[model samples]
Target: MSFRVFGIDAVSYSTYSRLQKGLHAISMMIIVWLMTSGYFAAYITRIPEVKEAVSAFNVALATLFAPVFVFRMCVSFGKGYADVLRSNDVMRYAAFVVHNLIYITTLIVIVSGFLMVNRDIDVFGLFYIPAVITDPRLHRWFSDSHTLACYGLALLLFMHVAAVIKHHLTGRPVLKGMFF
Candidate 1:
């Protein structure tokens, strides 16, 4: 009666745990890089090639990351919502909310990135995803929202990491649950 990842009946906790860990690690690394990429591009723009390279890299990373993230979101919330609700802990619920927000914001940022005009992206060096937005107003709006969402994601990530460290320091095995 429950949703399963890939409809596999015997999927173990260890399997989902590993999937979450890998996806989380990838998400964190990409986000951290993306947070600074704007500033980095500005600084290196004197060499126009570097700016182009940076833009291409950003698009490529997002292209590869999108599906993995979407998959993780699907698998993570499947059947876990009931467990989260039944736990009856405010902190756990808060953590779940923060996690969902992080995922939502990241997806928003990714979509906005895709919508932004002027950047030509050869995703994974195979196919190109062109900028479909040409309206200056809408483009600016999405671009600005993408930037804000990146900042919000950074803040959420900091809070999440701090909570994990706090749990580890306070001898709550919740941090260990993430690993084993």
Candidate 2:
């Protein structure tokens, strides 16, 4: 099927924005659940199996979303990076840094997770993502790095949400950009 918006033979900008926001919301919810499980469930639980399950789930979810996020970013921020950097607007420049920080921290978390896995993972029992790290020391390093990167991502996410609320509350209606 073919579609057009305003005589332009392409999807409308609003439709693209909605799709991007939908993907972001879904991905963030998964990531938050996985990240929090590591900090909460892994520690309070007495059973080894439960901790292992959470660990496995985190890695599987992170692996699955990593590429999808990268593609979403590329599509959403076509020239915004360079344009924002060149602009004199302090808010825009700061937003750009925070935005890139989220991406950098996410990639770090994913890569560090891949480096931390010790055994081949059977993702939801559908397919396998093979172990990428073997050495105990290297695995430990990656594990620590993964934990730290997850924290970094979490902080960036909080800031991003607060910023949106701030803009919306201050008569900006930035949230409307995502919906309605």
Candidate 3:
């Protein structure tokens, strides 16, 4: 569905903002999926097909989401956006904390999968990032970090959704300000 607000015919945000938001949504969904997939990978690592598919998905998601995240971080410093972020400093701070939590969690997830697999893992059999170093300690650390981050992310995401719902139900202009 397209984004619309009040009487404005435009989508929820500008083209760039929409793309950023779309990526945000896609990345979030994929990350959630990857978390579950990681559990499956851990329990069913013996399943060749499950391992291969999960590994490929992990690599592709990492590759796709990284640039989108980088761009979002860059644009976050631009003018005008500050106004939207200022709706409520307390909540805005909470959102910032949540964003960072997601970012760190995302990085750990990618790092874990990359470390767990051999350098030969390829996405779509087209691109690859060969592991430069091998140490079981490093891989295990990444995996454990990824697991912890995912647990924290669950709480962060819950708070974020709750805040959004609060804004919507409170009849505040917060959601509107974000799109404008």
Query: What overall lDDT goes with each candidate model?
Result: 0.74, 0.76, 0.64
| Winner by lDDT between candidate 3 and candidate 1 | 1
Better of 1 and 2 by TM-score: 2
Off-target runs (Cα >4 Å) in candidate 2 are 1-16
Top TM-score hit: 2
Rank all candidate structures by their lDDT, best first, as comma-separated numbers: 2, 1, 3
* TM-score of candidate 1 relative to the true fold: 0.79
lDDT of 1 by residue, 58-127 (tens): 7788878888888878877664777888998998899889988988988888888777755667887688
125 in model 1: Cα distance from truth in Å?
3.0
Candidate 2: minimum summed lDDT over ten consecutive residues — where? 4-13
Q: After the best TM-score superposition of candidate 1, give how far the Cα of residue 56 lies from its true spot, in angstroms.
A: 1.8
Q: Candidate 1's error at 84, in angstroms?
A: 2.0
- Relative to the unseen true structure, what is the C-alpha lDDT of residue 89 in candidate 3, on a scale of 0 to 100? 70
User: Which candidate number would show the highest lDDT if scored against the true structure?
Assistant: 2
lDDT of 3 by residue, 1-180 (tens): 454455334334342466556666666677677767866876757988888677677767666666676666565545344664776677666666676676666666566556665466555667766774588787677767767766776677777778877866665434554442
Q: Candidate 1 or 2, higher lDDT?
A: 2
**What lDDT score goes with residue 24 in model 2?**
72
List model 2 lDDT by residue over 1-180, tens digit each. Answer: 334333335332343466788877776787778778888765688888888888888777777887887777776765466778778999989888897888788778878888888999767787897887789999999989988887888899899999987875665545544542
